[model samples]
Target: MRKPTSEKNQSEIAYEVLRQKLLNREFAPGARIRYGPLGDEIGMSATPVREAIGRLASEGLIELVPQLGAVVKRPTLRDTTELYEMREAIEPYAAAKASQLISARQLKSLQSTIDTMKKLHDAMTAGKKQGQDIAVRFDKSDLKFHQTIMNAVNNQRMLTVIGDFHLLTEIIGAARHSYSIEVLEMTIADHTAIFEGLTSRDPEMTRKAMTVHIQNSRELTLSRLQDECPQ
Candidate 1:
């Protein structure tokens, strides 16, 4: 029997909300996701929320534990390494392609994200007390900036792959407590460079900027992992 269109829409809405929460690190890695409470908060029934969890589990973002139901997936050090490697290969190429193809509206959107990031950075630097809140917002904006560039390339496969990689990185980062004030500042600087390159519409310039940013991120992520799990 076919489900009602409204039911399907509710399921999708639940999925998107849950997915954003996971990607935004509102639910830390290994945190159990309870459908009932989530459904209540989102104004939906538990059934649709459960369906959403099932979808996330299939995407490797959520794990189905026997007794614990759905839990956010915890990424390993090797997972981090491989994810960065994949990003390094695909993102620079995507940025270069985007340089040639990105429309003015996309550029404007990218700039808007960067502007939001800068504001977050400023607030954090001013010693605002909500450090975690500020960090999560900054991460969300950072993801949006990269995603905007990916969208410009118009390659669905690469967009999907790279988007998941970014989300996984955020999960790992939240688990490790890896975002420091210095790191926030560095991200802003790197993104500013990438935005400038894109604005200039220079493929080589954009590609190089992206490569350098990814290398720096890889170095920081690996160093943090080593510090956390020294052998």
Candidate 2:
């Protein structure tokens, strides 16, 4: 059996686990997060679960409502727009800088992530995998791919900023479209271009590729949001 967490570690442990569930879309946008049941499910008490909920609330992943207690926050159009705007401003530049400075080890890590995404894409296209399962796994690999590039940048502040944004995007749940074969293939192609630019040490090419990828991602996110949360 697994060891139980101490009183001090319980809250932090609960927070991390719940945060990951949100990122994994296991809770999903607009899902209710009841402290009691969730605490039971996670083998923790309501006190720690409530503390965890408060932390996620501060992160904008969960909102505390009058009667509802805690619910996942669905991103509005403005929320999605502002998010991609920050991403557009930050990530492409990071990619460019990474291309110039990325070490061989970072490149290998990135390639491995990309390869995992490709396999997930193939499994998705073959109709051998369920949508949610494959999508969740693919999302993890996709995040790793971007994070590898961000790690290559060697800027602590940038990494933390973009890391928060990535979590926000995961919470937004717009990447749901990636469950489809078309979007999965498109994403793979975009990652391929970014990888090629990085491999060749071409900053301009890397920036352009990342820019295009982010633009495409933004459009897809907006389209999904429009369909789900129309005003």
Candidate 3:
């Protein structure tokens, strides 16, 4: 497993692992998350497990079932729609504002971001990607790349709010089972396009790219949900 990003507490590591499992669809939606099994699988213990799951329950990623204990939350079509709608509204604006002030150094970081994703993509094909073990790091890189831009947008409140959106997307992405080789390739390509727009410092193009990317993401996400739990 990729080392958890936060190092302060076992509960924190447990949280990241559980969250990733949920996002990656390693555990299906509505799947019971036994405390012992979760902690044991993550090489942790019950204490951290409880702490972690407790936090997730409050975050709406997990639910407390009276009879079955905690299970992954089943995101409704409404929830998915609302989450993507939130992204649609804020991410594009962040992209546009961020483009205006993005530095050359930051742009270079974005390029590196693309390079790493390419490596992960290659690793997946070769069966060497380490799956969730390494994917979380890649996800963090993606998060930071965009976060760097949001920071530049000079909107602290927006940044804070969008961070929550990122968490929600991360959960959805992690739990999404329909994700596969080709879909990820397309996603990486979309990232490339967004980076290209970022590099050019074209606010209009950045906004456009961001909007299209988020919209496409919404479609793909819904498609994945259907594959996982056909109605």
Location of the lowest summed lDDT over 10 successive residues in candidate 1: 222-231
> Each model's TM-score?
0.89, 0.90, 0.74
In model 1, which residue pairs have backbone atoms overlapping below 3 Å? none
Q: What are the lDDT figures for the candidates, one per model?
A: 0.86, 0.86, 0.78
lDDT of 1 by residue, 1-231 (tens): 996559788999999998788766789878999989999999989999999889888877899999999999877677778889999998999999999999999999998988898788788778773678887888889898999999999999999999988887887778665357788888888998998999999999999999999999888888887755323
- Residues 1-68, candidate 3: write the lDDT tens digits: 89763434888889888876664557767789899977778887788888888998987778999989
Point out where model 2 deviates above 4 Å.
1-8, 174-178
Clashing pairs in model 2, backbone N/Cα/C closer than 3 A: none
For model 2, residues 1-231, the per-residue Cα lDDT tens digits are 998678668899898899788768788777899999888988888999998889889877789989889988878888888899999999999999999899999999888988898888888778888888887888898889999999999999999889888888877763363468887888889999999999999999999999999899889888888867635
> Candidate 1: deviation at residue 22, Å?
1.4
User: In model 1, how many backbone clashes occur?
Assistant: 0
For this target, which candidate reaches the highest TM-score against the unseen true structure?
2
**Model 2 score (lDDT):** 0.86
